[model samples]
Target: MKVPKRVYEGLEAVRSSGRTNMLIVSDVLRCARSMGYPETAQWIEDNRNPYWEGIFQGFSPSD
Candidate 1:
């Protein structure tokens, strides 16, 4: 799926911060909703990719 630039950037920021935990996702969700991007937040919430999980788990050093 093609994600909006803002959503992509937000997730990228999260990933870049090396924080892939649920809490960080939660923050993104909140921001997305407030920013009128609920779908973006929902998409992030729905995604359960191992890559993302790995990032969340601190498996990727540069994530």
Candidate 2:
């Protein structure tokens, strides 16, 4: 069976840019949302300003 075009495109992008940490990132984003973190999503992505790196340490970024 053939994969959908968007999935294929996503795979291609991952293939080229090696962003294997996407799953971890997505999970963190979900958790942030459930906790009512912020709006733009980018709102919680900051480490030096808003969200600290320590806050994200528990989330393993391993694939």
Best by TM-score: 1
Q: Which lDDT value does model 1 have at 60?
A: 20
| Model 1 lDDT, full chain set | 0.56
Task: Report the error of model 2 at residue 55, Å.
Answer: 8.4
Candidate 1: regions farther than 4 A off:
1-23, 50-63
TM-score of each: 0.45, 0.28
In angstroms, the error of model 1 at 28 is: 0.7
Writing each residue's lDDT as its tens digit, candidate 1 over 1-63 gives 345566565555554555445456577577667656666577666765743664445432222
| RMSD in Å for all candidates | 6.6, 13.4
Give the Å error, residue 32, model 2: 0.3
Best by lDDT: 1
